[model samples]
Target: MALEWLVINAGLSLPEGFLAYLPSLDYLHDVQASASSLSAYISPAVKASLFILGVVASLINASVIPSSLGGPGNAVLEVQAHRGGLGHRTENSLWAFAHAMEMGVSILEMDTVFTKDGVPVVWHDHDISPEKCRGDFVGAYIANLTLAEVKSLSCDGQLAEHPQAKIYQDARIPTLEEVLDLIECYDNKMVTINLETKLDPLAPNETLPVEKYIDDIVPLLERRGFASRTTIQSFDWRTLIGIKKKFPKTVIVALVELETLMSINGEYPWLGGLNLADFNDNWIAAAASIGAEIVSPGHGFPWTDTIHTPGYEPFVNEDMVKRAHEYNMRIIPWTADDEATIAKLIDDGVDGIMSNYPQRVMWVGREKNRYVPRVGTKHRPHCLVNA
Candidate 1:
């Protein structure tokens, strides 16, 4: 009934840079859902005028201005590069994070699992994947390898099955501090790290115990001065609970997927003794109970994505979005790459998109009038990535 102005602004630090007062939910949804409506309905002259208006607006706003775009109240859409743009380069390598930072990803989404000596290193699988890495160190569990042994391997850059992936044949598994130090050098305060604990609840022996993360991981982040800029996420809620009880101020993200939820087994201790059944099976409330500010569900979780298999329904639809906000929690689903799926997530009003290809998501956000984190030119160290 009323027009609302969503002033999507960035003051250079907080990820919450974009802000817009939407007129109505229905209106925003209508606009987000209509990706091609402008080309279909608007005249060429008007489109050109809108393009020019957008250029001028971008000077005033970080994202392309909404005045010429589909709808009003286009707030910030946080774009996270899964495994720090895994689709672009090697997954979780210093090379990957640096490339993603250059590409303007709001969050460098990487997995962190403990090494044999209790040092936290950035790696996705507890057991190293043969497809992604190669060396004498291949086929060994990351937990069995000391930090030095893990670092000796070179990345093959074959992750996520992206065929055209730019391979950095010499890339190595970066320690958690090395990854953060790379970001520290880039000096982009707007960017953040979504560091996942990468622990599997069902297989506890493969990864280190939760206390290592609480004792070592938290302090590392704190010392780097990135404590305020980083988010600690995990599928196993055990570590999340530990961090909350000890630190009490860390930004905790409770991750949910079919496996972690124990979809077949009912209540299991995946959620740090807080069962989903106890919260009426509402994962949002379960996450909120632990002082989690964000609840990240697997994309199209509990079901599956139609992108891979058609006719499958997504779990993060409109109603779920409302339910998440009701608990004062944000829903940032994971690692989707397809354009149609990405647009649908944006339409669903998810706070962010964790994608292997963040540039594609940013393009969609621009088309849909959401905050696309400004891409920065590289001033990073030359010896690091050898561009």
Candidate 2:
């Protein structure tokens, strides 16, 4: 009966006596037979081997097969450009965003802060630092300056720590509207945006009120028709919950640091007054309760060094990935730049990775046969308009 089913559905016939050596499928009728129905009968180890072989074959032939058939493997892990490829360009600059798009990033990760006049702008830091920018008004707080005032600062200088790095000139702070316009005009229309709302718990007045922030940004996203293509992320869970209540369909990413989990004193402000201990440090469950479909945890880099205690463990591990997957959540770690670490994360089964150098991540993805091609445009120059 199994052989007959295979011949009818898959167009393949086994030897006449194959069924004699095969295990009986008393429950076969309960299963839906498909092209890859044989996978159910195979051992898990053999299934995995077949999947790897299929991926290699597809890569060699330049064709993709449905993952259900064990063909091109699982869904492609998303490669997000952190602050628009900050490793190679000034963080959050338009040029950096364009460069990342040219490199074929799956998603552009950035931060949003409100200008003094209540304009949403693309910037990472709450307070301007002279290390990344140079202007007449250095060390100014972003909330205190108008959009025009913010634009006067040039983020073209190389970081003093990395003096040998390339420097770009005339790159000024950009409004959220400007960035959305650029993404729309970009030839590759499939690239998504992961915009983080920069809110300070210690200094709430320095940023827009939670209600005001939602009111200001959601409309902009809807007007730009990016409500579907953007994921609103934040360390502050309150804002995310607020956004979820308002825009139910819009995706939200819960960003976490080691402090969020390891706060023995329960003093972490990013949790929005929720105690990690209450959830037994299961941040994934905590995020899901608030309607987050994705969780972006900090990569356990030694330099960050937040989780080095005797019992402390990296937040994004194999168990976390498995648990997240069980709940239909994605685990995409942040700012992984080193090739070795990126390779390890891919091995650990992350849904995606946010990196400062997207090119490096792309290379690793290709090596692992996990590279997801861009949705539009095959070839382009480094700049958007020229491309």
Candidate 3:
């Protein structure tokens, strides 16, 4: 009753299935006693919250969180370093990942594309753009080059656009294996790796098959013993659906953009063949259909980058978060770097955020008294140096 009443107090709607998991009386009593602090934030529910993401992902299925764990005031948003904190270093480079980890980001979010020899390389664009890379490898598709050839390219060159981005002195695009090895080098067991598959359903030929992603990544994560802390996210929902059924240990995230969520190729293959209208046009519902533990939507109108135009309307709001919570799914919106946007997201009750700057999130998290991950000591890990 107290849990039910408290949900009402928070002005959060109860889904039809909300009754399936009610808090025990002991937890209810704690909530009653801490009514003062309960008003501060949903203290007791933090047990089953997205704080639940890191700890409970292995214990539960993708769709439902059957119970709560502890008293409230414990919900902490995971600060995900988008493209390995690209605002600070070259996006998805070892320098960026290490720096972001050093700053105590809970998650290092990076993108991955396959090489010609079927090796998975950490990169965003399928075709290496001259904008981020230099040397002979420029303008070549990542899939067409071997891992050795891909390594010869330099991604540390700063462009006029990323004026504030710090150069890492000839940083190379590290492989997925190298990234996992670096995490081991840091010795930070609590940190999670949110890796995205750079597979474009619109242009499938540009990248390897979805099976290769599943085959390559799952085994590699298992082999590295990082399976428990790894989150595999993709705009293509096919991987999410497959990963859940095959590699149940890995946390699957449904990454939605304004474009992916909209119909494409006269159908919705991007969404694992499900249309928006299938679930009353709900992104969270559509995500849940494919067994996603977290539903990550784009920040606003454009839904691609963090930059907002004049009078930009947001795709994420309180209602979106509430609906996600009702379905027992976590909401961690992508690419919100500004202090105001981060604060508003926290206020809206998002589970976490993806950002290009870790310091900004850390400052806001501290100011708001939200739990940020433990700070990592700086290190030039063996993986980055040898590579």
- Selected candidate, larger TM-score, 2 vs 3: 3
Ranking of predictions according to TM-score: 3, 1, 2
C-alpha lDDT of candidate 2 relative to the true structure: 0.70
Displacement of residue 241 (Cα, Å) in model 3 is 1.3
lDDT of 2 by residue, 54-169 (tens): 33453353112221122111457788888888887778887778777666577889999998899999999988888888887788888889888888888887865435435568
Q: For residues 127-185, what per-residue lDDT tens digits would candidate 3 score against the true structure?
A: 98888888798998998899989988878778675689888766888989888888767
lDDT of 1: 0.71
Judging by lDDT against the true structure, name the best candidate: 3
Q: Which portions of model 3 show Cα errors greater than 4 Å? A: 1-74, 303-309, 381-383
What TM-score, to 2 decimals, does candidate 3 have?
0.79
Alpha carbon lDDT of each predicted model: 0.71, 0.70, 0.73
- Consecutive 10-residue window with the lowest summed lDDT within model 1: 1-10
Prediction 1 TM-score vs. true: 0.79
Which candidate, 1 or 3, has the higher lDDT?
3
By lDDT, the better pick of 2 and 3 is: 3
**Clash list (residue pairs), candidate 2:** none
Clashes of 1: 2
lDDT of 2 at 359: 81
